[model samples]
Target: MRADVAFVNGAIWTGDPGRPWARSLCVTYGRVAALDDDRECAAAHETVDLGGRTVVPGFNDAHHHLALRGRRLATLDVGHAAAPTRDRLLGLVAHKARELAPDEWVRGGGFDQNRIGGFPTREELDAAGGGRPVLLSHVSEHIAVASTAALRAAGIADLRRPPDIPGGRIVLGADGAATGLLLENAKKWFDATLKPHRIDELVGFLDTASRTALAEGITSITDPGVGGLDGIGMGRADLHGYLTARERGSLGVRVTAMPYITTTHALAGLEPGVDGWGLDLGLRTGFGDEFLRLGAVKVLSDGSLIGRTSALHEPYCAHAPGEEPGRGMLAFDPERLAETLGLLHRSGWQLAVHAIGDRAVDLAVGHVEEAQRRHPRHDARHRIEHCGIASPEAVQRIARAGIVPVPQGRFLWELGDGFLDALGEQRSRSVYRMKSFLDAGVVLPGSSDTPVVDAHPMKGIHAMVNRRTAQGRLIGPQERLTVEQAVRAYTHGSAYAAGEEGIKGRIVPGLLADLAVLDADPFAVDPRDLADIAVVATVVGGRVVHGADALA
Candidate 1:
């Protein structure tokens, strides 16, 4: 039998202990045809020798923000600097302002108000923007600071009360004036008025993002919130882009898209089931030819922790006496969330809710469990995104409900000290509790939540296993996992979250041909040097997508 492609002479980690190593693999029609000794294979249409380099199943980012990532590539990045002061931030904005055409909007992102001390006022933004419309997004993407010109462009001057929109806020000044900060839905009002990018431009950015992912050994990604109208418009176009790229032999990674559920009413026309039910245009969660597929129904339950707006059970540590409860905005009321969950659950759609604070996590978990009791979605594999501050009770409930906790392990490294300062040591100790979740028998799928955190799996693995901050401070040593456990969360555990464990994840026969070759065995490397381990090559669907020379 002739195989479409064959890889030989490599150290392969199948991610399955039973068949943890393989010398060769045959692929046909973009799926693994067989895995065994090269001598046993009859024939192959194409062959590539790895020269004894390491190989493993392609890394899957179980949760990420793809469109936001693309946008950030073109925006002013303030994330990499330290203690960004008012002057430093404006200096960067001013620099970007010079690069833009007059009257064209200047956009930037990844600014953390926590580190910056406070958000910039509209007047300050206007001065730095040089009379042009300027919009800078918070690192969390839940909030944005816009200049007066931008507000004028959006026709939102002297902002009065909006019609009680859920899950959003417009911060007001002492004089009862609207500040430049637009939280959640309010940010959408300004974003909607911004210039739209051509589909080709978006596709190009996506190409760049994909290449970057491959360089990091990422072979698959689950996009948490794809902006679209009933899975049409942007979502449909993105799906087409992936398919077109694959068909034209340009794509090298797999994508699982989750539709954002801002309005449950939109799902009315969409069908249910993995096949033709919720599926459309040859796309289904577990279907397709392994390039793109529909995954989960994503819902934003609360705001961002950095924005100091995530719904918490107690007031923020920084809150003064007699202050309003710092509990963040909820996108939907409990009744509304319950209604949406019931509809989706009854329709057999998988659900993933973004819940950050302990209170938000409790609410989201309650809704999922209640939906299960009312509608009984046994195999949907519901998940809670950003279970960042899970209490012991919440963790137990998550385990009891059999919900997957997709935690952003990198946050511990990225914001550990700040979190420790903000939430107090007691609460901070519970941040990204991988070992606790594992002990409770809950599946803990590690993720990067890119654009918010760096999307390096090694960074996540190191943080998960070490439970240390970037400065080497031990934040939650008791919550650390073993090296093997962390790796499994990135590989098989993520696959299970997306309901693709049977087809992807492991480097075994009958699975999609997605693998990553590394410079050294992660297990053998020093724990402190784990983040330095390099990706020698990355292969997806039988093709060498990156580092062909390294593989040899």
Candidate 2:
């Protein structure tokens, strides 16, 4: 076959076991024709010399929020780096509030109360915002603090009778008033009442995010939670936003959309436990082409580990000196979870359940066990997102069941310290244990729960390899992975999570021609230097989609 594009003088990690390295490759019909094959069949094939650059399969983030992350990119940067301390965070937010009109929404996010000692109170926010309806989300997205004006705007005029949401909490002050902090499902009240973004408006943000992902050499992403609104106010259409971006000629990367099945009635009549899903669109898991498709049904089984909302088998260490220890609450009954999961499994849908704490992980595994016995479907490939706090027995079950764990490798770098503090030494020794998973024959795919941490695959790889926290403390020396193992998770591991390993993930003949050209070889570089390695170019579908002559 004639080649549409040919590459030579390159060091390519093919991700194939047999043909691991390739000096040259050819692409035709948006698929790899051959690796290191010499042929003169084409008279007009385009050839490019890679100048000894390293090529790897384009990264596929197994779990991330697409449009929502794009929206966060447009919002205020109240992250730890920006604020550093409580006073600085308040000042930054107040400064932003002063610029916006009082009637306008003054939304900000990425503020970590743990860094600032404790959650910011309503009075503190009120003093800074000058009557603006300011809201600052926690780094984990499981918690947030709102100004009094914002609380009123969100229909929370009284904390005394706050909305009774399942698996969520409204933090109240000693004065019997709302403290302005909302946790878990309580955050959804604000999310449901938060202002809505039109399809085009959301597309703008999605486009920006897509471009950013491509520039970073991320050719594909699985948005795990679409149609799951996390804000107050109703009518979220982020799933449609992807369609809008693709239709408007703005989509820059491949996307795998997973519609969240929630009881929030987030999507019209598509609530959890509901039948006749995708009847109108006529799509379910595995539907659509390579460009975009439905991958799994996302169901949150619990909250964040760092936020102390994730259900734990044992009581979590107290966050405050005097506060009682908490056994994190489960999001649903285990029996009901089994029934719902069985229905989805029998219906031929893939499952991506978020289970952070050990108990949540156990419940998620139990549900899968029940579902498998009820339906007995092979190759379900069910994924446990986070799968953070796994027990010894649960790890065995996960490996035996062959469930894919989509973990945030970046968490080892960013949240390892907090995890250590919360779980204590013995339990904390195994947080996000990559080595444990690999040792148990479990597939561990790398991902960043973006908006929670940096989404750079190299950064994630570095974390997995080093297990170094932000403060330069090595938390779990036992959980570290080798550079190659880490890279494999980011590429092939993620593809396995989405059932796209056959076409994508690997640079091999007959596979989709998705490659990322790096200026430095990851295999040869010092482990510490991985994150510093830059992506020189990105090619998808046999075409250079980013960098070099992409503009041409």
Candidate 3:
């Protein structure tokens, strides 16, 4: 049979071990038809010369929040790049508030109170908001700052004192007044009374996100919180967004979703109908087709390291006088987590729990172990997202349980400075234990955890090989991986994490034709310049999705 497309004259680093490298590839009907020297490719209808560029399997972000990222693109970006200082952040919010009518909400994110020195206050937000309800999320997403108007709107306006609850926090000032800081589940307060986005709005967000992912050469991504809708407007879920995007042909890349658990500890159904978002019928993980599918059930066991809320085994090092040293915080009653895991696992749903701190890691490990012991599923490839601050023993234990530790390689480059300042050198260097996970027989998958950081796979690769922070300081020299290992983690390892290794992640015959062409070879580039290597072209399903016009 004649090939549909012949990608010729390129240096391809096929992820498949048998055909590790190839000079050309052939694709027919969206599947890889040949590795090299396929005579049928000569009769192909289309022939594109790759100009001898370096090619690798397309990137797969094993864990990401594309919907949220898409929405953030339209929100006020107070990220380090946009508003680097406290004054600039408030100025942006105030400027945006001037454009809106009174009582309108000023919603935005990417403000790092750590970089701003401390949590922002309502007084500051009020100065720019003009009676508007302002809600600004931290860079970590685990924390947020709500203005007085927002607080009053949420029915917690009196600052002299605050309501206390389990698994959440409300930061208070010296006089016991609310400081506009909300942590963990308390961040939900600012989300009250907002209307959920229409299905069309969701489709727009998905399109924006998919375009960005394609430009970055990411062919696949798994959303960690699909149906949870914890922070969606209107307290309702946009569960139909994925299906709508797919139906409209706007979902440019493959997507896998893990339905997040609700406060009732019940899972959302596979389909959304008239009755609430929860289906209760019969749909576990591993549902759906190739473009849109179900992945593991996602659960966030603890907060984030940057937010200083990931339940840790020890006290945090960064602190001032009259302040709580603050280790971290964990969620879900143990019984609740175990019971939920038991039900999901027994129903054949794979699990993906977010565990950032060592303590949270222990809880995740124990729960998985207990659940597996109670009802064993031999090939269940449950995963722990972030696996952020694991110890040596924890890595070994995770490996023994056959759990893939999906880590964002970009964290070291982006958040390494804060990590070092808060945890000291020894502890900070040990976080994300990439090499150790591999050494301990674990499949250490790589991802971007985007919206929290840049989603560029090359940036993540740079972090993997250099272990350098944003300030150019090296944190953990010992954990540095070679280019091949780093690339595999982002490609094959990520596919394995999503249980799609059989279909994607490789350039072998019969696999899908998803590949990325880089301007320079990673192995030949300087370690620091790894991220500088541009994606010249990106191909998915044997068709070029990005930079195709540039190809000859």
Candidate 4:
């Protein structure tokens, strides 16, 4: 049969050892035609030589934030510097201030209190910003540091809480004045009031993020939450943005968007199995031509770990005496969460709940299990996002419930020190326990949670295998997984979580042709050197999205 393109002279790891390696693959109409030999390719219409490079299935990031990633690129970056001190952060602010007009806001991201020693105050930010409104996000995206002008611009001159939202705190000084720190949803006040980006500009942002993900060997990503009354504004705008980018031939990676639960109310008016539900807008959890789709229903159960706002069973170790144990905030009351899950589960919509602390995880898992039992649906494939600080009991319950734990392995690499400090030794030791989850018979999918950390699968793999902190301390030596196990969690495990394992995870006949080419075999290298492996190329549906060079 005539083929559109064929890649030969390559070492392919198809994720299935039974048919582990292939010498060549044929492509037609943007799908895998066949895995064949040179003789088979000679019969094809076109052929290219790979020069014996290593090829594996394309990396699938189970968790990521596409819009935030693009915003980071255009904003000031304080997270890249090796040990960002006060002076270095100020330097970044000053540099950004010079580039913007006097009144324009200077937005920056990737600032961490752990790295910078402490949060920047309004006075400090004002000095660095040179009279412009400056707003810098914490590395976790759960907190922010804003100059006095920016706070004032958001109409937060005096410390006042919004009527309904709880668990969001605005740090105040001893003099009863507002500090620059905005925790949890309080950051949204400024984020929402900021100037909106044009549709063309937003599309450009998504294009840049997609190209970056492709270059890093990422072929697919699940954006957990988008759009709502919450400041993100991802609903119709994000839909149009992805559609525009795909039409312009600028999007190279597959995106599965999980719209926020607040938008679920809007979908209530629409009938189930509605044809072209966001499909014309380029959406479908299990649809599309594989480039973009809607994946799952995203719900937030609590706040963030770093912000000391995640709902937990025990008091935060860092909480001051007499302060309310710092038990954190719950995004939805138990009844509300259970009701939401019941509705989504009955509708056959897969759910991914963001539950960070052990208590929140337990609550979410229980709700899902109860929903499944009462509603009794098959192949629902519900997931607990973060699952970061679950106890052994919670882990067993999660496993028993048949829910997937989509943990961010990159957090171990970026926030290990802070985790240890806040959660103490015992709880911190179990953080990001990939092996424990697997051993308990729970499906564990690896993710980057990009914008929170660098979304490189290699780095995530290194953290999974090494489980070490930036200071080189072994945070959880017992929680480490082998190289092979880590790879499966990122690829096959993630596919399973998305209910696409049969068609996309393993490279075999009838599977999608999503693959990555590497400079070196990850299995052949020393465990400690896994992070050093370079991505030579990334191919999705037989198309070469990125490469070290064109095939010979």
Candidate 5:
């Protein structure tokens, strides 16, 4: 039988356990039809000579922020790469201020106080903003700093008398004035000014983000939050934004968008007396087809680890000068979290809780266990997002619950130094555990949490194998995973996290025709040089989505 496309003369890592390698494959009607010698010289409408390059299943990022990444791409970047010093960050703000109108807002993101020396004060932002409102987001996106003008734009009339916000913090300075720092839910105040007002605007952001994903050979991504109430998502129209993106042919990668759910507050369109909260008309997880499908309901249980806001059992190793010393704060009361988890689980929604600290992980684990016990669903596939500081006991419990731990290996290289500073030498070993999760029989999905760091999967893979920090110090030597295991985490493991392992991930016949051709073999390269390996071509459904000109 003839095929629509044939890929020949390559080292193909199929990612299937039964047939791990193939030299050639044929695709028919957007699905793999033949593999190995069976497809040699098969007649096809189109042929892609891999030119003896190494090909693997396209990368699948289980936890990413496509909307946020796209928005950041359009904004001024004060990140470590763009602005390594405090002066440089302020310079970028000044440059942005000059480019914007006097009344227009100046938006920027991806700044880390640790790397940039210290957080920008309202006074500094005021000077750089030049009468325009300025807003700069932290690398974690859990915290943000606003200029004095921006504070007024958010209705904060008096800096000394900021409004009380639940599940968030408005940090104050020594003089009892707002320090311009907003944490967790407190960032919601600026939603009106920062959030995209139109569905088309959000769709534009998706288009920009998808281009970046395709260039990196990312075929699928599970966005952790959308339509979230805490101002984290693009509001209620976020689902429509994805649909519009797909319809317009702008969304290049398959997406599994999770609705951010909170039981503490009433959702706008929820049916009265319903068992739980979700989209209207009983639309919950698994509602849409491939390319743009609903996955889990995301519930943030705590803040970020690097920001020192994630709820932890023990106090942090160190705190910024003049800052209060504590274990950090939880996003919700324990009882409220339990209630939310139970309601969602009973209503048949897959849960993905953002739990970073050990305390938060244990809290999520207990609640998920109770939820499943009260309403037994063997295939619920609940997840712990981040799980950054899981204890050994927590790891065992995560395995027992069969919960997927979606952690970013890229964090090892980009934020591991900060993690080391916060957790100290002792507890740092458990940070972003990879080998531990695999050894415990738990699936460890790979992710980048893009806009938080670089979204390149090869960088994540390198971090997983090397376990080194930006400063070249090893934080979790024992937690390092092998190169092969890291690849699986990015492919099959991430696919399993979204309940699509049977359809994609592996390049065996009958699966989706998605693959990435690399200029050099990742398995053959030195672990240190793995991040340098670049994708020469990316194929999705037998179509070359990127690097077609480079394809031989």
Candidate 6:
């Protein structure tokens, strides 16, 4: 009756209310078999001495972009650390241009105009590219700038007369010439430059992302978008890439991929009579097994808040020169959005609508409510991704509809200044509200939206508890969460959002044997030092996936 593997001499945060802590844990066949102080519990074929370290359930990032993060890791370095100034950013682009062939695109990402002083001008990029096309994505990934060469390469015959794009912007200068700043869906026009990755290339990206997640003690992730919709995902073959990665044993962490809603059209299997709004027959939400599964249909209902494109009720505090002031834009018209949500809901697919601004949130809330009224389904667990700015009334509606609000706490640390500038002081306080959602009796899942920021769960936990911006400014101090509450958000809260709470979130008996052993206890450390704590070892299903060398 001995366990298969045992961890001894450790402090385990079980995440279960009744039994909150344990001194030792035993795993049998990849499920937590027992948690006891008895030395007998340590009698297993293989027992690891934890050396009194602290253990918690492995983190589950509810809104990460796996393959995209890996791709960014391999791209040009222009983030705050890599290029902190305008000169550094342009210098990096220039250097990349020199290394590439004259015809190749000089690509870069993760540059923040807020920190790097300002967005690089199209003319400035033209010089850096030296006639080579260049495209540098803002850290938010919602906006990007392309060199003049790139516009021509993309077949734009007239810079001043670019095709009219709804739900996107092609910035025009005072002279009425294109400014090269592409916002929201406008980036899709340069698909030739941003080519879709091959299945093998996608698997490679997944491999890189998996290693990074394991190192961060993240055992499960819900990638918000895949299947190349609106130029956000990898490609149409993205699901195949994930499956190949899993079959090849390259993906070490569990993934619940939310395929783009429109991707269903491009996919095979459309019955002549049946609606084509969902996956093939018998494949809906919760389709696959533990390693890889379909979670929800990702619908990009609005743009990025930091990018100043999210639909808002009030005008933005700041504006670009020569630009008229206005509230942000929605990706879909209200009628179109309602129709889409209704179709998906009736088809038994959970909807993860990305609504950032209060204006967009209102539409999303109303859509979900109306969908349920028309065709009610219990425990549907529809999610509102990045419900960034929810008023008290909106929060109440969210709770009443049993919607999960997936907000990234790391945004406070990475994009807080941009948010402050965009929404001003009063409205900024309501952005990314954590405590208020909890107060309204709603589950708030923690996420990083990585590649936009750091993916470490500790960074998210620290940001949630501190609410401090990168400039040392604190916003919404009253909305700050306790350290324990923050930790739970990354653990049980995220698992609950993905409907995996019964299996993986807690370290209780019969739950998956997934744990993250840390060098220091998050509960015992200073709130400011949460991000500094290192993961000593990471275990997935009783097998050490990261830091095995240190444990050995």
TM-score for every candidate vs. truth?
0.91, 0.94, 0.95, 0.93, 0.97, 0.96
Candidate scoring better on TM-score of 1 and 3: 3
**Model 6 lDDT tens row, 1-552:** 888888888999988889999988888999899898465575787988788999999999999999989888878878989999999899999989999999988887998888876778899999998988898888878889999988887777799998888878889998999988988878755553466788888888899999999999999999988886465788878889999999898898999999887676422334555554676664778888888999998988888887788999988875678766578898878997798788788778899999999999999999999999998999988999989999989989999999999999999998998899888888998999999999999877889998899999998999999999999888888899998888899999999999888888889999999999998999989999999988889999999999988777
* Tens-digit lDDT track of model 5 for 220-331: 9999888854557877778888988998999999999998884223345344566455556667788887688989988888888888889899988766687555897888
lDDT of 6 at 472: 85
Specify the poorest-scoring 10-residue window by lDDT in model 6: 265-274
Give all candidates' CA lDDT scores.
0.76, 0.81, 0.83, 0.79, 0.88, 0.87
RMSD of each: 3.4, 3.1, 3.3, 3.0, 2.1, 2.0
- Per-residue lDDT, model 1, residue 359, is 84
Put down candidate 3 lDDT per residue, 1-552, tens digits, no spaces. Answer: 789999999999998777689999889999988877658668888998999999999999988788878878878899988998899998999899999999788989987766777777989998889879999988877888989998888877577767785678888887778888888878854454444667787788889999999999999998887664463222245557787788888889899887776622444543363222223566667778888887887888888898888989898885776766788888778788878777777667788889999899989998899889988999799899899988888888999999999888898887888888778899987788799888888776789888889999999999999998888888878999999899999999998999999999888988889999999999788888999988988999999999988795
Task: Indicate the TM-score of model 5.
Answer: 0.97
Model 6 ranges with Cα > 4 A deviation: 37-40, 265-276, 319-323
Per-residue lDDT tens digits for candidate 4, residues 287-364, read 554667778878878877876778888887864566554777777778977887787776667888989988898899
The candidate maximizing lDDT is 5
Rank by lDDT, highest first.
5, 6, 3, 2, 4, 1
lDDT of 4: 0.79
Tens digits of per-residue lDDT, candidate 1, 1-552, equal 588888888777788988787888888877788888464354888888878877778888899776567668767887746226767888888888989887998888887776767787888888988989999888787889988788777876555543334467667777776677888777765565653456666676577778788888899888887755322123435556556556655555688878667423433344453322233342334555456777777887887776877888886676456766465777678797777777667666788898988888999899888888876656768899988789889999998888998998888887776677667777788777789999998766768988888888888888888877766778878898988788888888898898888898887778888888888788778777778788888888788889987655
Q: Which residue pairs does candidate 3 place in steric collision?
A: 194-234
Tens-place lDDT per residue, model 2, 140-234, is 88888988888888887676777777778888778878888888888866787764677777888788888888888898899877765553212
Instruction: State in Å the error of residue 430, model 4.
Output: 1.7
